[model samples]
Target: MNNLKYSICYISFFFLFMLSMVNFMMMIHFIMNNMVIFLEWEIISLNSTMIIMSILLDWMSLLFMMFVFLISSVVIYYSKSYMSSELNLSRFIILVLLFVSSMMLLIISPNIISILLGWDGLGLVSYLLVIYYQNLKSYNAGMLTALSNRIGDVLILMVVSWMLNYGSWNYIFYLEFMKNDWEMKMISSMIILAAMTKSAQIPFSSWLPAAMAAPTPVSALVHSSTLVTAGVYLLNRFNYLLVDTLPLKILLLMSGLTMFMAGISANYEFDLKKIIALSTLSQLGLMMSILSMGLPDLAFFHLLTHAMFKALLFMCAGVIIHLMSDMQDIRFMGGISIYIPLTSLCMNISNMALCGVPFLAGFYSKDLILEMVSFSNLNLMVFFLYYISTGLTMFYTIRLTMYLMVNDFNLISVYNLYDEDYIMLKSMFILLLMSVVSGSFLSWMVFSYPYMIYLPFNLKMMVIYVSLMGGLLGYLISNMMIHSMNKFIQTYNLSSFLSLMWFMPNLSTYGLSYYFLNFGQNLLKIMDMGWSEIYGGYGMMKIVKKYSIFHGVFEMNNLKIYLFSFILWMFFVLLMLMM
Candidate 1:
């Protein structure tokens, strides 16, 4: 029975993937001819749009799905053993299939409603799987993660509402709307708020670290490579919508803030998995900023390259924890190069890729993003700021690589290489291979027509040189600083001014619902405390939670408050109904 279920997932995955692949080939053929389908047909609503099934075939959609399939397949195979001691195998496999299906659907969705449905569905499956452990911490983290996603959804829904009313329900309609309207600015702003929340952007990012409660395979599959990137994916999917709007500028601001903070968080985080998790947040922010600039091609390339190195890194981290009695703290891991030579080798290469060493995969993709930022004609000052942040990314990436592979600190016994897992090694090496050449391949494609898209190769080389040097310098600083101080570089909290250091975007069970409630509580206190001083010239004002007319009105839960909000919305609904 277990074999039957396992076979079912593998079969379904391949079949759907092939179907999407064929659809994509057809789409590219259509796109080259500038064909546009009317996404909706009342006769059957059966418009076969290219974007609708791009999950397997469209250049942008297919690129991301490649990462999805690569990591997810290995995860399933790895899980065959990882879950060997567990019961409920079928249930787990089913959820994994559902999760993959949702992501594929999202990638190819031709319309906004379809995309949102897929987005919400993916979040639900991820939440279910995240709590797969059902331990106290896992359950808490799952519930918290779910709440954060819901908050993001709320922001998206708000934008959808505005677009449908002021713009149009169809996503393709944004191009037309942008030509004649300003309302898209508000819609874009709202949509990006949703994006930030989904990507685990700053202040809202704690859910990702908490998400480490799930199995490592899930970490590599859902959290790192696929679902967490959905928000950025959406932003890129509609790159044209933000082309030259104020919302695009706002997105740039959010991107810078998120990347800077995420890098800092990664710097100080102690857990191996959490460090990667934080790094995912930081990199996704960098990706989002790049996407916000209307550089779809660059964003897609980065997505592909990041998946290769990140998966390799996480798989190695999994092996590290497994061997050291599930030791996840970086402090507890050192001199690891001795025992697991194969893993050490893979980790060393993967670390180099992450640090953007030239000739490595990261060097190309990350360098393209920075070079583009340096040269975009419209925003000179903004590009300069982004360039500076790229330098920050360089510093942190070097810090991480040095701590894992080269440092003389925290020496410990290294176990023998875990060659029992050949698939794991193969997966890591495949990514490493791609990491080395993806940039070159992408560069060749772009430079195919130099007059049309002239890449500043000379300038690009200089930037790469500077980026690599920055990483080396940062690594050296950590090395010398560590030996002299005899302590971890993170001990001093070098990035304390980043206020997000102390706050979690969605820390506990209480989320926006709690925030709104607290807002009301404070407002009521302000009125109660100040009313007597203003009205009667200073008798005491009671501090009380007891029922008063205004207190009752103010203390209603989110539902009733929403109910009253519905009354205001009724005016609009009735107005529409009357019209």
Candidate 2:
């Protein structure tokens, strides 16, 4: 049975890898030839309306599909070892396959209705995956994840209904024509809102971290390529409608705040997976803000490159967690590099890539994004948000590295930690290779010409400067200790706010629902148990009882009442006859 489960994983890994290769080649072909193929299947036609399913085969979709398949393939292979002891490993693998298929459906779709099919599939499957552990935390996280994405699903449905104006569901064809119209603005606004919910910008950001209840393999696929990126991908496709629009401007501000907020939040985070999840959130903000700047291509570039390293980072974290007896807190982890050198090496590489170290995968894209930010005529607030967020990226990365690699081992004295699991190591190595080379490869393939960036020397060095300062702070802060008292207690409120993602989780869950729940309780008291009960069931019972009492009185006096009535009738009849 275990062998059969393993075989299922291996077979999935093989086919997905082959598909990724094919998609990669096709993406290159489409890019070189500047071609787009739209295949439409008409499901129904009524009057002047048509419900057609349209598939868009372009370089962008193909490239994204390739990356999705590649990461999914690696994640599945890694899960075989990660979940080897589980009795229901086959169920896990099947869910992952379903997720990948849904993502593919989303990528190929150019119609709103079809997109919703894929969109809702992602939400539902993700909810299932999040609660895979069948624990309280997993259940709560799954509900949060599902409900948050449901907002997006609803927005998409609204867009579908609004698109009925065109008598067709193929939104790609109407993007330009609808750009200047009021209805188009409404549609675009809804689309942006939907995307924001899925990508988890600002108010919607809580679910991404909560979703860490999912298995690490799911995190690797969902956070890195498929689920979170779906929103960004949708926005990128609709970039034309967003140019010089109010919704785009608001998205810019929200995404910037989201990036900065996540970076700050990650620094204060202790959980290994949550910190990584927060970093994913931060990178997502960067992609969104860039896309909002009217450079969807650059956003797409960063998205692809980010996927390579972020997935690798999660895989490394997974391996470490597995070996550490499921210990996720960084405070209990240190100097594991001495015990498991290969995993540490992979972890360090991925972390550096995440921090945008020179010449690595992230540098090619992140550095370009910073330079582009400098080139654009943006305000100081936006400027600082971008640079500071970059620094915070380095800050958390350095702190995380120190905690896991540099410091002394703070866990049990006697334990075995070895990097002998080749199945897991092999999967990590594939992503490790991609994390090193994918940036430059994608830079060359995606863009025909390099961006022309011109900036002053100070602005040019801003990213490096902020990064160095952030790294320095990270090192110093991690080394400091508070004697005789907990440091967080000294600044309880500030620490609470920062560590808790600015109370976003609280606001999203309790804060938003508190009033509604309170109102519901009031309704139950005043309606269901109060006026409603009186006028409804309780009142009807009272009326029925009163009638029953009146009937009982009549029955008790029945003979006396009958004799009196007969005497009155006889006297009245005699009087009438004499008249």
Candidate 3:
């Protein structure tokens, strides 16, 4: 049965791979001619407005779908090995397929109503995937993932309700016409809110790392590529409506801060998967920041390249985790390249790409984004956040590399670690190849004209200076002898704060809900156990019993005789009056 399932997945991957290639060719043709194709079928009509199913096929959508399909295919192929020992391998594959379908739905739909189907689908399927292991950790992570995304889901539904004012659910048609409309502007704010939750920006950022509780392939496909990117893609589509708005500016500030915070958190992180997950968060912040800066194209460009390398990075982590008997701490993993050289090679390449090494997949997009930010007239804070975030990115990447590849082997001596699995390597190599070439390829294909960055010399070389400093610091700090670390015990609070992501995990998970949980407990005590008992069943019973006792007492006192005599006298008086 497992063999049959694997075969089916492989066939589907091959089919999608060929389809993406053809779609890419068609997208090129459409771009060359500046053409667009739209298809719609009406679902319902209310007065002058019609709710309809709609799909827009343009170069952007085509290219995005191409990447999505490619990544999904690779992730599915990779999962065959990763999930081979699981009893429910088929279930995992189906969930992944469903996730891909939802992502595709989101990509193609321009109609707000139609997009909900896809949006909700992604959320539901992701929750299921997150809890696939059925463990307590997976269960908690799944709930957090679902509820976090539900905020965006509710926002999208609200946006749909607001779209009724424009008499159409097709937001694409009305973006330009409703650009300055107060109602539309309000809708745009809600849309940004929705995007923030989906993209893991700011307060909504905690879910992304917690979601690493999912299987590694799910993390590769969903967290790294498809699911988290949904928000950026939505904002990219809705960029026209966000022009010069306060919400957009707020998005800029929050996303920039997210970029900085996530990078700092990654440097302090020790969990192998989580460190990579935090990097994904940082990249998402970069994309959101760029989108907020009115360059959705650049954001989308980074999105694609990031999808490639980040997915590859996660897959490499999966290989390591699988080999190490699920030990994810980087402290226990050193000189890993000695055994799993190919996996290490892929890891280094992806990490370097993540750091935006020259001519790599991440470089073209990240470099452009930094240069564009430098060129723009921005305040000191946003500017420094960009460069500092970039530097922090390199810092974490180097630190992670040093811990994994160069530090002493801290393993229990009995285990075997080797890159013997060809299946995992094959899946990883596909992404490795793409991560190496995709950035330069995308820069050429997406941007017909290069950005002419104008900045002073020091400002122009800012990324370089910060990156070099970051590299030096990463090496020095990561390589420091362990016993000497006691000197900084006084700064334990500050170090703990950074290590725990400013206590954000606590803030988002327990902090946000601790009051509610405490309130619930109090309510249970006062209402359910106390007041309700007194006021409801017990009180009613008491009243009934008291009346019964009074009646019994009255009967015991022979009150029925007095009651009969009084009634007879009243009846006689009434009879006499009638006569």
Query: What ranges in model 1 sit over 4 Å off?
Result: 1-57, 163-168, 377-388, 392-394, 406-417, 444-502, 505-579
Off by over 4 Å in 3: 47-49, 481-490, 517-579
Judged by whole-model lDDT over C-alpha atoms, candidate 1 comes out at 0.68
Q: Could you give the candidate ranking by lDDT, starting with the highest?
A: 2, 3, 1
Encode model 3's per-residue lDDT on 23-70: one tens digit a residue. 899889988998899999997887888878999999999999999889
Q: Which has the better lDDT: candidate 2, or candidate 3? A: 2
Please give, for residues 277-348, the per-residue lDDT of candidate 1 as tens digits: 777777787788888788867777777677777777788888777777777777656666766778788877
| TM-score, prediction 2 | 0.90
- CA lDDT for candidate 2: 0.93
Residue 141, model 3: Cα distance from true site in angstroms: 1.2
Q: Between candidates 1 and 2, which one is better according to TM-score? A: 2
Candidate 3 displacement at residue 63 in angstroms: 0.7
Q: Order of candidates by TM-score, top first? A: 2, 3, 1
Better of 1 and 3 by TM-score: 3
| Model 2 alpha-carbon miss at residue 183, Å | 0.3
Residue 50 in candidate 3, Cα distance off native in Å: 2.5
lDDT per residue for candidate 2 within 97-153, as digits (tens), equals 999999999999999998999999999999999999999999989988887898999
